[model samples]
Structures are given as structure tokens and as C-alpha cells.
Target chain A: MILPGDLSKIRSLEEVFLIRFRLDKKSKVPLLLVVFGVMLILFAILNIVLGSVRISLHDLVRVLLRQGENAVYDKVVWDIRLPRTLAAILGGAALAVSGLLLQIFFRNPIVDPYVLGVSSGATLIVAILMLTGVVLEMGTIPPYLLSVGAFAGALAVVILIVAVSGRVKQVVTLLVIGLMIGYVCGAGTTILEALAEKENLHNFVLWTMGSFSGFGWEQVSVLAVAGGVLLVIAYLLCKPLNALLLGEDYARSMGVNIKSLRVVLVLIASTLTALVTAFAGPVAFIGLAAPHIARLTLGTSDNRALIPATILLGAVITNFCDLLARILFAPVELPISAISSLIGAPIVIVLLMKRRTSL
Target chain B: MNVMQTKELSVGYDGRTVVADINLEALKGQFICLLGPNGSGKSTILRCLAGLLAPLHGSVFLKDNLLYQMDPGDLSRTMAVVLTERLSPGLITVFEITAMGRYPYTDFFGHLSREDEEKTWEALRLVGARDLAERYFNELSDGERQKVLIARALVQEPEVIILDEPTTYLDVKHRLEVMEILRELSRKKGITVILSLHEIDIALKSCEIVLLVKNGKILASGPPEEILSEEMVAEVYGIESAHFSSCLGGIEMSNSGGAQVFVLAGAGSGAPVYRLLNKYGFSIITGVIHENDIDYYVGRALGGAVVGEQPFEEISLSNIDQAASLGRQAEYIVDAGYPIGSLNRRNVELARRLMAQDKVIYSLRSRQEFEALYGVDGNKPVYCPNLGALAQRLSRRKK
Candidate 1:
């Protein structure tokens, strides 16, 4: 029955995908890992190559090797875009993984990374800054204050949301409350924006648009460290999270501290989303969309596969979208949120429709 | 030590108590079926045992450890639960779902270790669902879903698994399969299996012990034969029940009269005419139904008669001959309150011939409401009420 010809049979693309997918505990894990490793390299090269002033691969390599005459090109590539690109990858991955964790926790597919209400929470503080006409000596609004305001706002919102959602016991009900909280925050911001002076209003509006280009080495360093720690924490809790997917009782019966784990994981998720949102101005669907894309692609929620897949996919897509956002509007660059939404909404819609029809 | 023990357990929603109990010690590795009608706190009790809900008054003990005192992780390591809750929508595959059982053992980041993977695979194989490892959890059939759920619980490697009415919504065959899986888990794995179900006969056959829950108290708890008597079942359900023993030491409940009628019913509105015979004592009958028809099974269960070929392939044919024979003997035929379609003339002829024989045929305007009495003659002395009694008042024929 075990024929050589059968082994040699050419598998269709889908079949190949499934076969590769089936081997979660394979010897070729290193090879699969290297595939993502290569993606990181490609993402770096893309970050260098695609920008406001496009640099050819030949010119980019020569500048990196220190043989080219284009010292100015080197500064633009390495000093400016490279750090921003790295920050985008980190922010995107952080948001996405956080979103995935939250969605699974609430058992709601529509649950975004900001289920902790980081974006709206952060927006509230940003709105306050606008209303108070708070200006530091710096010509540009200090990224540090924005980051601090966002984190505090997000933490407060998450603590409240978790307390409410846990008692309600229905995902949809919790979602409505969360969305309302977001709207309330948004409503408050709208009032603040209406009352602010022209200069304060401009600052608030610009910050809300969300730009990755604003991140410096120091800001990127903080997010990279914080996001990295929580991502690891999330990976460790994969089993507990998987249990929670079966519902609160199942998780409790399995000896998982449902309340404590919920609190801890939400804290971690909040930290990830807050750090990213604080820096990138609430990058939108990266946190909400990327995890689903990774899960659908891999056909598993075992964090071993999902975490890495989300990371690689998150970074790749964010870099690609950032590239598009810069180019699509020509003179005036579009926000990274627009690029993500254009892709994210269709992908989510397709997944929803597919589930309905299959049922 | 008993695998499970409870002392004066009182469960409730918020302040009002639902399941009030004294004390009980469960024998280890026994298959226990908690039987009760709907909303009798069977689920509430199960949840308390599984540590999902804590008892308000008395303490719960699992393997002699105080339940409330145990860490949630430790409790999960010892006990597993399956409630009738829908899964969160996801792309989770069967393997991942089962591996979730290993949650208590893993670090906070839930990657399964080598031991976790082995345990999950063994659990999947134990449930005979290893082949479904790659399939999406939601894509599985009802039976497969039930098995996979069991598999997920099994991998927790718990001392006890508690399920609350796992048989609801499943067909008879699927229900049997689920029960069998539980039986195997109890016997072979030496795990104490506790499940609640509405299927009385299946519960009696599969469980070693039966716990009957009734009106905020325990009705009875003992071996199947010792507990599930006719009087007890009748008292619990308020329906007439007759017990009969099979030659092989099996107990079967004999039939009770139901409200169902098999009117070798015709198309169009004529079926509604006979339906006007709304007397509980005047029973309805079934006849010559097409195969794959909805009413065929309903007729068979109602002890109906039939005459023609019931489709054997596309549908289940149960005692069609008996149903048809009853249809043939149908006397005092009513038109079921409708004009006839191109149905078999046998029923129509029966109605016409019965009318010619001076069996009073009354016209009804949509007899569906009346059929609550049974789609039969209203003039006869059946146990319950009918239109004839009302008509007699108009005619001054009280005598």
C-alpha cells in the first residue's frame, strides 16, 4: 500500500498547505522558523527600498557596504526610515497578538486588540491635552507625554471593562458596553476638540491620524522591550487561553485561575496595545486583524504556531501597508489605519460570510 | 476515598437557592446519571461539583480535598466539565481543541510541551477521533463534536468528568454513541463520569447509579433497577408508565397513549375536517403515508396504522404494516375538515361509506384546533369533550 509513486504524487497547493500545517511537532520546525527569519530580512530590505525617495537595490546595497558616494541617501535610509519601519513591525505585531488574545478571551471574533479600550482611552487623554492647551517647550508635541497619557487611560478602561464584562457573561453584551465606552470617550474627545483653540485643535487632530514616522530610537526601544516581554508572557499562557476558549467553566474545571488569568492576560494585552497605540496613535486593525489572518492561514490557535505566524504576518503586512500609505496619496501621505482597514474589513467580512454559509 | 463528596450543598442564582441537598458520597469510577425534568437544578448541581459554581451553604469535596479551598488550577487538574455552551467562533482545529485540556500543566504562555502533545494524542485516540485531528472543530458533526468535547476533557486527565445533558439535540443514534463514550471512559479509564440526560431508558441502560433530582431535593439515588421504578418515574414525570422486563434482564417501559393521530391524511384542506374531533379520549390514527414524510414517524410513535409502502431507503419505516392495518379498520371516518385532493380514494371512500352507513359526518371549518381531541368521530362517547356535546345543546337533545 505504501507505494513510491504515491509519495511522488504532486500535491495541489491546498493539499501542500494542509500537509505542512499538520506537522506542528515536526523536525523541520527550524526550516519553518527560517522561513519567517527570511521574512524579517526581506522586511528590512523593503523598508530601505520603498520610501518617499525610492532607492534602487543596487544603490541601497552599495550605501550599506560603504562603497557608494550617496552619504545623503544613507542618512535618509538608516537614520530616518529604518527605525520607523522597525517600529511599525514591532507595533503591528504587538497590537495583533494582543487583539488575538482578547478575542479568544471574550469568545467574540469581533473583539479587537483595543478591547482593553487603549485607543479610546488614549484618545481621551489626548483630547484632554488638546482642551488644556498643554504645550511643552518643544515645537513638536513630546511623544513621551502622549505615551504616558495613553497608558494611564488604557489601564483605567481595561480594569472597568473587565469588571463589567466578567459579570455580564455574554460576549455580545460586553462588546456593546466596550463600544459604548469607546463612544463615550470619543464623545468626550469630540467635545474637547470643539472647545480647544486653533493650535491645540491642530495638534489633537494630527495625533489622532496616527503616524509611525514619529517614533524615534528611544520610543521604539521602550515599545520593543515592553511588547517583547508581554508577547512572551502571552505565549506562556497559550494553554490557559486555549482552555478559556472552551468557556469560563471549562477553564475553571481545568484548574486555570479564570479570574486571575483573565486579569493578568488583560493587563498584558492592555500593555501591548497601550504601548503601540501611545506611540503610533492607535494603528487600528494591526492588533484586530493580523491575528485572524495568521489563525486562518495556519488553521490552528495553538500559540506555538499562531504567535510566530502572527508576528511574521503582522510585520510583513504592516511594512507593506506603510509602503502603500506613503505612496498612495503622493504629496500627502495617508494614515497607516486606512491601508489596514481597506484590507482588514474585506478579510473579516469574508471570514464572517464563510462561517455563516458553512453553518 | 470517594472520588466526589458533597456536604449539605445548596446551589443558587445570586440569593435564591435552586439545588438544596443534604450529603452524599459518590463511589469512585461509577457512571452516574442525574435525571430530572427541565429546570430542576440538575445543571446547577453539576456545576457545583465541577467547581464552576461554589455551594452557598455546604462544602464540596473532590477526592477528599475541600473544593473551594483548592486552587482553580488544581481543581481543573482533578475535574473536567462539559456544559451545553456554543464555542467561540474561531479557526481552531480539533488537535488544538483537545490540547486545551493540558492548560493546567503548561506555563502561562500556552505552548504544549512534549508531554502535553502526547497526552492530547492519547486522549484523541481514546475517543476514536484521531483522524479528525486536522479538521476544524466547528466542521465536525454533532456526534463528532460530542466526542471531541469528551476528548478535550479526557486530556485534562481528571479524576472526574461532569457533563450536563450532553444528549440534547442529538438524534437517538448520536445520543447512544455519546453515552457509550462516557461508559467507556468510566469503565476503562477509571474516571468517575457524571452526566445528566432526558433520555430515561438510555440513562438506565448506561449508568450504574441513577440520581433523580426533583422539586429542590434529591428524589432517589441507587442502582438503576432499585431506583427507576414505575411509580417513581410516574411520580417524577406525571405520565402513565408501564415497566416490562426483556428476557435478557433488560427493563423496557411499555407504551402510554398519546395525542398523535395518523390520518392516512390527504392533500388540500380535507385533513382538517376530522381534526375537529377534539376529545382527549377519542384517539387519532395514521394510515398509508408516503415514505420520507414527517408525519410517518409521528404516526408510528403514536401507535398508528398504515397500509402502503413506507419508503425504506430515504426515510425510516417503523411498523408501517401495523399503522396501515389500523387505518384499514378506521370506522366512523371524518373528512378532517377539508376538501379532498388527488389522494388515495380509500380514505375518501371510507368517509363516504361511513356517512352512507348513518355514521354522523359533521362539516368543520378548519378542524386543526379540534384534532387536539383526536381526528375521529365527535358523536361517540370518548373520554373528553367534542363539538357533538355543544351541538346537542343547540338541538335541545341533552338526554
Candidate 2:
């Protein structure tokens, strides 16, 4: 409701206005923060409320408040859906921020966690552990150990890339090396899968098709805590990462400790990729697409805004994809990667078409 | 007081030394240009100065401290580098790109304070790119992009700025624009500037001190007026001495070996004949131009032997004597139309005398016009209305 005086003030404010949706466009960063924050919360709730179980909004609130009447509904909601939803949130953000870091580090728009072979390396180690009867003591092994093994394998590839990065000055050379490493690790995983026992094959195959199902509270806690820690480290690196966008020599001239910064970027990116690969297989394209989405929406590559925006966008996208994976098939869940690629690939194509100058 | 200095520095890549023993010092607010042929280690020396590459031996000093040993943050605060590498950061605005210069000054997370933002805008304004703040960096023209890059360096608030071939791919207008901005920055801001340039003319015009690099060493370093001589340019660039004139600013051309042609021209009319003669492989001698005449500069720079008079003076007997000797020695003569002023009216007598001789006289003027100007009747010379026709007639004479 605007009076005559208020209408005149609004007309005066139009001079500085650019795009609509913000009252004061000069303070658009804070406005974007608030808008994205609200959207993230809304999407997170929408993800938890709508699944195969068809929990009503009222029951969703009751379950969230821990005062629900139905014990079976509570078990399904709290035990199954909550952890899975949380895994989607944490895992999505970890991969997204990791992708953003690699993109900045390599100065390539198409790079992501899998481009560096982290996902393939983690998959290979997990395949070896699952298929070789190494983890089957009395026919059962904890998921936590599987995550640890996946992390070690991803870290190994990361360390290898870091060792070679010093010798290679060209960014394309480093990316090609990373791709070859991915190929070798992928071939090893394929060979191991072909030789696995008949009963163990199903589990190994399921792990290969990335999903947010089967996450327990313990696994969720580890993903959350680890992703949270790495997210903070990535946030702290926003300044240097922005500097690096100008290229290494310029970054160095701007007082960025490029050598140490490269080490930290690799470690953080690899750890984030490992966390997702260990728990949910190799989730595809979220890391690559989420940052692009944030950049397009917010109109910036300055990582101070881009990092948080990417994290939130990544979490929202993965959660939405996981929800689709769960409900689209009803009783049986589809692989999250298939749905993500189905949706994420087109966004990349559209981005390429829209921003042809960048391409 | 010296702001930057290097002591016996050796620079190269991966164990091979490209440049060695580069001892030099630069005073504050000095604009120095490194002039060299391609791959003459100009970039290597600049890289060493910018601290991007460690020197193979010796050291660079920024004021009192060793450059390589200084804390990177402190060094970066004092000096910034504008590299030749093109930035392709996607979707980034010029304001954001320019603000990156505040990296060393900004707090940990790189959030810009009010003062930092002001400095960023001020830096953009300094490069006269305030309007480009919202424009994308990649979308800018080459000249505008270079300006934004320099603005990024300016926001670092450095006392010294090093640029490596900053005007490599720009057109004439844009090249001059960039040089003007750098000169203004050095003059008004008192920022010491060191840049590498391929155009020695621009370097001679703009740089206070010139470092001529060749064969992996500093060949010479001094003020441009003193050290940029015809012999020095010939030795450094491996061109003939006649091709370069430092007083006229490094104008050069290849010597065309053909017949000798004497051009009777003055008051800005002989420049084209001299250039055409040089281009068509004819040895040229241009005559009786005043010292202040524009033709004299072009003629001399293109390796033409010119008979000269004092500025605003009459054509003297000595000048006519030199012109007659050169005209008698020539196989061909071009009568370039000069105005019949009192000071240079004797040039008509020189042309009339050359025409009376057996020399093949090519006139840009018509038969009646040449006769009227030189006070000769019915002596029709070969007429060439343009330089092209003149070149064609001369080339036919060569056969």
C-alpha cells in the first residue's frame, strides 16, 4: 500500500534501479543472500515433506516437532527420509563447492570432481573392497570403513596430481593428465567389477550408480561435519580463488601464495569429492553445473558471493534430484546420477548457448 | 633516489639462461622502456623484475631489500605487474576484475570495505575506464581491455608497475591511447613504469630511459636522446645505418637497389618521390629543401641524399652546386612541383638545367605547367600524374 508521498519516493528510486526484484539494487548482494537463504530453507522442507510415503504437511510438521502419533510413520520419516535428505544436502554442497574450486584452479568451466578422477579412483577402491571379500567379516562390514577407504583412494589421486602440477605449467596439460588418471582408475574398477562374486556384484553395481539411499545417522553426521569443515576452508579461500581467476601469474602478483593455495585447493576439493563418492557413489555434474547456475543467477564469479550461492544451489539441486529419484519409481529408487545428468546436462547446454562469448 | 635496481641478474627457463649480467638502476617516477627484437630476453628480464621467475644468479632490489627475498605481500604492495596474458574469466565485470588489485590489502575473505571500493573506482577512473565498470572484461575491445588491466594494477597502489609488451596487438590509435595513459600515470601519479616495447619510435618519444637488449644482455642503457643513435639502432636491430634516423624517430625502410634518381623537390613535395624511389629499388638524391621543410625529414630518413638550405633562407649557390652535381650523376630526374616562392625560386633554374641535360626527367606536373613554373618553353618531360605512374615509368627505365 503506497500513499502519494511514498509513490513519489519510489519514482525517485527508479533512477538507480537495474533489474527488478530488489527495492534497493545497490544492496543486491545482501538481497540475493536473503533470497537464496529463504529458497534453500523452503526447498529443504519441501524435500523432506514430499516422498514415496506421502506424509502430509501436518504430519511432516508433527514429525519434525517429534510429537507424531504414528510410530511406524515416525520411524520411516525420522530414520529413512531424514538421513537421506540430509545426505543429499551435505553431499550436494560438498561436490558443488569442490567443483567451483577446481574450475577456478584449472580456469576451466567444464571441470568437476570426476574430471580430476577422484570419483573413479574412489569407485575403484570401493569396488575392490566390496568384491574381494576384504570387508566381509561374518558377512557384514560397516559403511564408515567403506567411506574411509574411498577417501584414501581419492586422496591418493589428488596427491599424484599435486605432485605433477608443479612440473606442468599449462592448464590444459594438467586437465588432460587428470582425465587420463580418471580413465586408468575407471578401467581398473571395470575389470574388478567383471571378476566379482555373483552375490557381491549387486551391491558393487548399486554403489556404482550413485544414490542417497542407505544413509544412516552415523554416516550423515560424518558427511555433514566433514562437508561443513571443508566448506569453511573453501570460504576462507574465496579471496585467493578470485585472484586465481585472473591466472597464476596475476594471482602471484596479487600476493596469492599460489603454490600453497594450489595444495589447499586440491586437498579440499579431493576431500569433498571423496566424501560424496564414498557414501553416494560418484554423483555426476552437480559440481560443474551448480556454480554455473549460481554465476548466471547472481551475475558474478566473485567467489565471496559465488561460494555460498553455489553451496546452496548445489544442495537444493541434489535434494530435488534425490526426491525425484525416490518418487519417480515409487518402490524402487532410480540412480541419482542418471536424474542429475538428465537435468544437469541440458542446463550446461543452455548455458553454453546463452553465454556464447564465454564458449 | 633509486626505486628499483637489479644486480648482475641472470634469467631463463629450466636451466638455460636467456639473459645474463643485467645490472641496472631506475630512479623514482622514471618511465623506462626495454627495446629489443623478438626473443631477445626482454620478457625474461621483466619476469625477474616482477618476481614471477627467480633469477638464475644475482638479485633484484626494490629500494633496500632483495626482491626475491622480500615477503610476497610486501613486494606486491609496492609493485604490480601487467602481463601479456589475456584474462578470460567468464561473466566477470570490470569493476570486480579491477577490485582484484585490492587483494593484498583486503582482509581474509576479500570483502571490500568502503575505502577499498572507493579505491577500486578511483583506479578505474584513473585509467579513464569508469564507464567500463559494469561491462564484462572479455567483451571489451583490446585497447579497453588493456586499460582495465592497467587499472587493476593501479588499484594495488604500487610505487612501481612492470608491463610486458602491453601494446602488442593494438592498432595505431589504441596503441597511442595506451602509451598516453601509461605516460600520464607515471607523470601525475609518480608511479615508476617499466615496459617492453617493439616500436622504438614510441619508446624514444615516451620513455625517459631506454634499455636496448640484444643477444642475451643489456646492450646499452641511457636517456633515449643520448643512446638511441643511428649506429646503435643498426647494430641492435641488424638493419643498415641509413634506414634509421634517431633525430626523426626511428623511421626505417629496406633499400631498393635500382638506378640513381635525383628528385628536384622542396616545401613538402619531395617526400613521396623519395619514398617511391626507395620502394622501387632506385638510389635517390633529393635536393634544395629548407632545413625546416617536412620533405627533408622523410627524405633523409628513407636514406635519401638531400641538398639542404637554412630554414626560411634562399636557395644559395652552394646548394645549387650540390644539386647540379647530384643531378649530373643521376640516370633519372623527377621534377616534383614546388611553389615558386622567393626563397626557393632558384630551384626552377636547377630543374631547368637538369632538364636541358640528357637525364630522363619525370615530372608530376603537366607539359605546360612544368614549362610555366621553370620558365622553359616547349621542353616536354614524361608526365606522371601520380606516384604509381612515376614508379611505373621509373621501373620501365630500369629495364
Candidate 3:
């Protein structure tokens, strides 16, 4: 919180931080539009090139095309780095958008999409599957099925909070209820995990680690469909989402169909979040931090600007962190979730400190 | 027949009803004010009519369409509102906030059409916030924020606009500015303007129709001068002895003789008294204050002479001499009740001096105090429920 030169004027740092802003409102979207697009591509390339095997760009592209079949190179690129990189990019952006929508709908800065016990649900199912020695075939229930389960679980938590209201409707209470639900689900998952057999426990540990190595193009296609559908629905409800920022009554007064919008937004955000978490194992803090970064950069709640900004920021940050995670440990690559928490925490703090004095 | 009317509209929150039998209306291009006490259900009725709240008993008809039955898009095109709602107050520019008012007409992409953009700009100009269009909405002062909120409501492109406490946090200039903006909007766009206000003076000064809401219903409605007659005000507010008169104290002192009369008051205790005393020509005088009181500053701002005692350490014979001189010229001596029981002799002496003067009308605790000062009969002291009582007393004294 750096105060400007004069307190009497009480001006915004948006101007003093003039390097970031422009006055020509219509001239937006052109310059940063191209820059963000290129940034995404660069990070994606880096995520692929920096992993353990030194596959050349040509070899990687050839392997992606199913042409280059040198066993070691194909395994490194096809079976290891390529799917992981794609998962990082898609999962990052999807969760980021989900967080953005949830924050806007609940009108709470701390309202992460996964906070509604979503990841807990996925973990519970995976734990159950492990404890029971239910060996899911390689492609039987891809991350897509997990994501669908998580989406339903997230929706269930929301319904629970809505129904459980002897308490106030303030943001703090909502956050506490979400956290309580998460803890309860986590406890259930833990009980199942404690009773699991050794061989089954080993597989569950790998799933919980959230690797990109398990997925391929078929899984990517499902991610694409879920993310695309959710993003489209989120975009359509932008006005109502923004209106809800002023409170439900005000939004109602403005002719926003709140009940329908709430149902649609919750469904879409939950699905988007569930998809990403399923594929990447609750990529820590990306959903929470990416939207704040987008808001800090773009400075508006109009979802048109916020959604695109969050998407771009999500891609760049997640891919960049994933690149670091693989290269830092090199041959014995670290979990992408660990890298996300490391970078995402500090950025979220800066955003909170700056906006604390206001709603 | 009013353009926007309610037939026994009973509005409430959750399962509990607040305003039950509210029958009210506002003609096209008219400014209607709903005046009531804190829990009198003004906002509930406003919300129900705005289609934000459901009616428990009856329905709201907006230009002949049942408000609840209309499609949100269609209802939004014909309705807009300003409320005392706390928002994110994000880093949005005033232009962006006003632009959101056009959301009903904007497509899914939220791109403002040429017509929408023009209306937003015009709305800003109308509220005199055109210069602040580029300013961040969250960073503005309360007055400026109120204006921006009003501007946002105006750009909703509605046939009727409802505001809840439009002047709640504004200064004198902004309060008048908000009222004037609503007035001008009613005239220019033929939009029915309805707002609830606690500022009785502001309602008297501006609104064409004053609806008195109390006990879960509208007790009266019509022009401010007619419907807001002395008796109606008294009944609605539970105020004692409301009256309207041109002459002060039965004497025609001047063309404007009977000004609102404010008695010398204590810290914030005079707020109600000041308000009740307030009329167009009435002047304010805050005094008999110790140096370090919050209301002493308020009284100072109210711009009246004060019979202020000096700081205790500095209260030599010189300060007492100064106090005594002013006390002689003082017309009304309302006991400020400083440091009750008079443990300090200075307050007792000051009280003695005020009660001693025949021309100075003072209200003390008892007839003994009155008889000890001006030597009047030892009758019971009149009970002052609020500022209005003090004003009527001062007005009577002016005769």
C-alpha cells in the first residue's frame, strides 16, 4: 500500500502507475491482445522444451504428429512432457476463469472456485477407488469423469451453504462454511485412505500428486469441450454477474434474472473448476491468484475484460511455473501444484494489501 | 389516475411483512417523496414497486403491467434504481459504472451501442459528473459517489426511477444537487421519480408529492404543502404540536418574520431540535458551550453567536467579564446542562446570569431556577420532547 504524494486529493495510483494504463478506452484489446497471445505460445514452448529429455523442437513436433517413433524420444515427449504441458496451460486457464466467476458471483475476493469442496470430492472418489482395489483401465475414466464428479460435489456444497443459514449472509460466513465443508469432506477421504491396501495406496498417491503424464489427446479433447462450454456460458452471463456485484436487490431492481443467472453461473464455474482440478490434481492457488492478477492488470469487473485477462494471465503464469518446476529438479521433476503455490501466494498478498481498505 | 400505482401493495422481507397496506402513486413526470421514521418501511415499499421485493397481499402495476410478471429485460428497460447499497467499489471508472446501466440493452458481449454510449455520457453530464467520467469510482468522495450512483440509475433508460435515501451521506451541496437532478430528470424525460428521504427539510423543499408512511401504510399523500400540513406531519412522525405560520410570536416583525428558531443546544442533543427549528428564514445560534465539545464545533458551523466559557485554567475574572457582557445581550438562554449538579461554580454563575435577564428567555430545570433568575412564577418547566418544541417556544418569545 504505497500512498501517493498527496492524501488531500485522495487519487488513484492508476494514473501514478501510468505505465500500466491508457485513457483511450476504445483503443484497448489491440496491443496487449497480441502480446498475451504470443506470451501463451512462448510459455507453452518453454514448458515442452525444458523437461528432462533433450528432445529437439523438430523431434517433439514430429512425435506429436506420430511420425518420429524413436522409443526413448517418443516416450519422453509423447508419454511425459507434451500432455503435461498441455494440461498445465488448459488447467491453469480454466481454473483461473472459474475463480474469477465465483469471486464475482459471491462478491467475495477469497471465494476460490475449489473452496466449495470441489477438490475434496475428487480426492474422496480417488481414495475410495484406491482403497477398494478398483483398477480403472487406462482410458476408462479419464480426468473428464473425475471433473464431472467434482462438479457435482461443488454444486452440492453450494446447495448446502444456501440451505444452512441461521447465520448471516456476509462474505466471512460464506467462507467459513465453505472451509468447513472442505474439512468435512477431507476427513471422509482420510478415513477411506487410512483403510486402503498397500498396492492400491501406491496408485492413489500418484493420482493425488496430480501429474500431466497420465493424459493424452482424448483427455485434452474433453478438457477443451468442458472449458469451452463453461467459458461461453460464463461470458453470456457477464452483465448479470457484474450487476450482482452491487448486491442481489440492486441486481434484481436492474432486471437481472438472479435465480436463473445464479444457477447457470454456479453450474458453469463448478464444471470449469472440476475439469481443471481433475486433470491437474487441484493445481494449488492458480484459481485464486490468476483472477486477482488479471483484475490488477485490467482494473474492471466487466467480465468481458476480466475473463480474457484472467485467461491470458492464467496461461502465462501456470506454464511459466510448470517450466520452472521441470527444469529446477530436471530428471526428477517436482509437482506442478507445489510450483503454483510458491508463486501464487505472494501475488495474492500484494493484491489483498492494495485492495483491503475497500469492498 | 397515477402513471405508477400500487393497489394495496404489501411489501416485506423473507416471511415478515413491513409495509402492509401501502396505496400510493406518482403521475408521469412527477417527483414523489416517501418520508418516514427509521423502521417505517419506506425502502420496503420502494423495493416492492421496483420489482425487487415480492408483495405479500397485493400487486404493483407499472404503466398497467404487473411488475413481477414482466420479463426482467422488459422490466429493466422501464425501471431503474439507486439504493444505499454497498458495492465492490472496484477500480472501475465512473464512465464504466454508468455504462453498466445500459446493460439491459447491451448484448452479451457488453459492447455499448452508439445510442447506449450517448445516453451514458448524457447521464454523467446531467448529474454534473462529466468531468469525473474518467475518475475511478471507488476513489471519489461520498458526495461524488452519490452523484455517480444517481447517474448510473439515470442511464438505465427507464420510464421510472426509484432512489432510497439519495442524500444519506451527502453534504449540503450534494443533497440539493441530487434532489435537483431528480427534479430535472422528471421534467426532461417524463420519468416518474420516487425517492425515500429522512431529510424532512429536503422533502419540503423539493418533492411535488409527499407520501407520509407510518404504521405499515401511507397515512397521507399529495403535494408537500397540502398533504404535508402541520397535522399530518405530527401524526406521521409522532411529533407533538406541528404547525405552520408566517408570523412569529403574533407579531409581523418583517415580510419574513417567523424564521425557524434554534435554541442554544448541547452536543448533538440539538440535532432534532435544530431540524425542527429549521425553516427557510430561521437562523441558527449554538452557544453556552465549554471549549472542547464536538457539538460546539457543529454549533460554530451552524453560524450563530456563542456565549462560550473560556478554558477552565484561563477562566480568570477577565473571561467571566466577557461572558457576563454577552449574556446581557442574549435573547434566549436554553440551559445547555453542562456538568449537571453545578459542582463547578462557573456554570452555576453563568446559569444565574442568563436566568437573571428579563429579555433573555431561558428554559431551566424548574420554576425555582426561573424564579431565581427573571423572578417569574414558580410554575412547572415545559417539557421539550425535541427541537420543534424549542422552536415554537422561541417563536412564541419573539412576540
Best by DockQ: 2
Q: How close is candidate 1 to the true structure, as a TM-score?
A: 0.74
The CA lDDT of each predicted structure is 0.70, 0.85, 0.70
Interface RMSD of 3: 2.5
lDDT of 1 at B240: 40
Give the Å shift of residue B144 in candidate 2. Answer: 1.0
Worst window of 10 by summed lDDT in candidate 3 chain A: A162-171
Query: Can you write out model 2's per-residue Cα lDDT over B105-186, one digit (the tens) per residue?
Result: 9998888999999999998887789987876788799999999999999999999999999999898988998899999988
Task: Give the top-scoring candidate (TM-score).
Answer: 2
Q: Tell me the lDDT of model 1 at B14.
A: 83
Q: Write the per-residue lDDT of candidate 1 for residues A71-174, one digit (tens) a residue.
A: 78888876778778888889888888888888887777667876555689889997786556565455666668777887788777877876775566555576
Give the TM-scores of the predictions, in the order they appear: 0.74, 0.90, 0.75
DockQ for all models? 0.33, 0.45, 0.39
TM-score of 2: 0.90
Q: How far is A12's C-alpha from truth in model 3 (Å)?
A: 11
